[model samples]
Target: MPGNPALTEATYYILLSLHKPRHGYGIMQQTEELSGGRVRLAAGTLYGALNTLCDKGWIVLKTVDEDNRRKEYQLTDKGREILINEVKRLKELARNGEMILGEEL
Candidate 1:
């Protein structure tokens, strides 16, 4: 598993955010809005996730709003594919765990 780091929950949501174009503050606001305020990402965490997502090419830098100088991002095709796969994997893992615990039949 060398060089393959697991994604944090915040990281995943950051990727999810890129499904639409959003800036740093927009991301934080949208994340809370999207999660019903149960999950709020701090500035530092959001920036970190943004950087990681950018570095991995999971998100592309979109238009920048110069009036406010805010940079936005959007999901790449590869990013969408990865996110989809990650969702599927999580579902499978949850199913297996529930079945093991006799919660699923």
Candidate 2:
């Protein structure tokens, strides 16, 4: 099946971070850690991406704490599929680059 072509790096990382339910702050921290501090997401950017992902049906609100004020999100089946597809696409791009460069690093 054809996956979303408009998924950005931030969005991809966000989705990957939601492999488990996590709040906004957790998502940001995990994303940075996952990318080795290369993909730090600001609060505004992260929230916006979360809204978009939720609207796209790739993610859903998993929980909300009344007093803590933290809302957790998790990936839906569609989200997992999309994440897997994106990984495949990224791998293919890397493979093509390696082939063209003709030098394995």
lDDT of each: 0.79, 0.89
- Tens-digit per-residue lDDT, 1-105, candidate 2: 365475798989999999989999999999999999999999998888899889989999865878877789999999999899889889888889989986655
Q: For model 2, what is the error of residue 38's alpha carbon versus the real structure, in angstroms, after optimal superposition?
A: 0.7
TM-score of each model, in listed order: 0.79, 0.89
Q: What's the count of clashing pairs in each model shown? A: 0, 0
Model 1 stretches astray by more than 4 angstroms: 1-5, 102-105
Best of the candidates, TM-score:
2
TM-score of 1: 0.79
Candidate 1 lDDT (Cα, whole model)?
0.79
Q: Candidate 2 vs. truth: CA RMSD?
A: 1.9
Per residue, candidate 1 scores C-alpha lDDT tens digits across 79-102 of 898888778777877888888987
